[model samples]
Target: MYKILKKQKWSDTIYSNWIEAPFVAKAAQPGQFIILITNQKGERIPLTIADSNAKEGWVQIVYQVVGASTLELSLMNEGDSLYAFVGPLGIPSEVENFGGKVLIIGGGIGIAPIHPIAKKLKELGNYVVSIIGARTKDLIIMEDKMREASNELHIATDDGTYGQKGFVTNIMDDILKKESEAIKDIWAIGPPIMMKMCTRVANEHNKQIWVSLNSIMVDGTGMCGACRVSVGGKTKFACVDGPEFRGNLVNFDEMMLRQKQYCDQEREALMLLEEKIRRQASNG
Candidate 1:
């Protein structure tokens, strides 16, 4: 069992965790993920490797408590142990000196994974500009960390509660108008819809954009075939081939459809867990 070193609530539904995972921490790189199981009977879920400290023997993961497994995880605290932790999985982000400006776009909890990528790009001598957004102020996350990792940061919210009133796309459009030729590469990680929109914007400018797919993954290894995605007219498993791919070449509609495959079952499971929680509360 892997021990949880620390845990903190980042927002009403989001939580940050630090786990004592020496092996994974040592091998982890920006953009890779970990597959974790909460308990013996819990379903395996893949979480991005937000950050890691090899010497300290810890890896950071930030997730939204949206489902049964995550809700149960939210109730656990420091010193708690996890049933299984397997990772540093998937391919690492392709980091290199692009010799020009780099744009990193993140939406909602997606900001967590972008943090490490932005940090690494900056270290490789690229001028990193980060554009992040959420539905409102309450959901905007990882602002401080993104700021430290990037040379400049722009924020957007649908409600106008903070930063620009529109979406991150608005900011990206403005920047592209002035700096399109200067931008060497773009990396965006977010909800599927958000990534699709970002890909559209990049395509308009003829800019190459790399997107991380939140495809439904059953096994971290390639054997399951559950995380397959179509890119450039070929089937590629997000588990092995990528969670990241060239945005313009990916079929977002199909990927989005695949993501919703378990929604009904997920809702049922969540309802059952909620009822169980209520029963325990009443008994207590």
Candidate 2:
């Protein structure tokens, strides 16, 4: 069992956890992920290794409580032990000096995994521009860290609650217009729709683009076949082959539809839980 060394609530439903997994931490690399099981009967969930201190034997993971399992995970506190923790899975992000300005784009909770990539890119002597956005200001996370890793940081909100009044792509367009020649590559992580938009923008400017995909991953290893995604007209597993892929060749629409297959059931579960809580409160 791996212990939860610490936990911090980042936003209303987002959390940062420091887990004690010395072996996993020592082997972790940027862009890799871990599969964790909260309890004996719980389903395994894959989460990116946001940061790690190998020497300290701790791995940090940031997650949003978006589903039943994630919500249960949020209820865990410091000193709690996880049933199973296995990892450092998935291919690491390709890090090198590509000799041109790079733009890193992340939307909502996707910023959690993009942080390490942006940090490594800047360290390699490339000018990194970061763009992050959410529905509103309160939902935006890791702003300070992203800013420190970037030469320029642009923020946006769907509701105009902070920074620019539109999507991150709006600011991206403005930046591309002025620095199109200087930008050599773009890396984006987010909801499928957001990634699709970023890929489209990059394609318009003929810039090389990379995207990290989060599909249904049952096991961190490729054997499960749960995280398979279509890329370049071929089958690729997101767990082993990549959480990262060339954005231009990915089939975002198909992935998006696949992700939504259980949306209605998920919504019903949440509603039922809320009703149960209400009944308990009323009885009290």
Which candidate leads in lDDT?
A: 1
- Candidate 2 residues 1-284, lDDT tens each? 58999999989998999999999999988788998999987888889888888999999999998877787789899999999999899999998898978999989988888888899999999999999999899989999999998999999999999989889888888899899999878888888899999899888888778999889888768887878889999999999999899999999988888888789887876677667768988999
TM, every model:
0.99, 0.94
Error of 1 at 249 (Å): 0.8
lDDT of each: 0.93, 0.89
Model 1 Cα lDDT, one tens digit per residue, 1-284 = 57999998988999999999999999999989999988898999899989999999999999999889899889888999999999998999998999989999999999999999999999999999999999999898889999999999999999999999998888998999999999999999999999999999999999999999878888879998999999999999998898789999999999999989999999999999999999999999
> Which runs in model 1 stand beyond 4 Å of their true positions?
none
Stretch of 10 with least lDDT, candidate 1: 212-221
Q: Report each candidate's C-alpha RMSD, comma-separated, in the order given.
A: 0.8, 1.9
Count of backbone collisions in candidate 1: 0
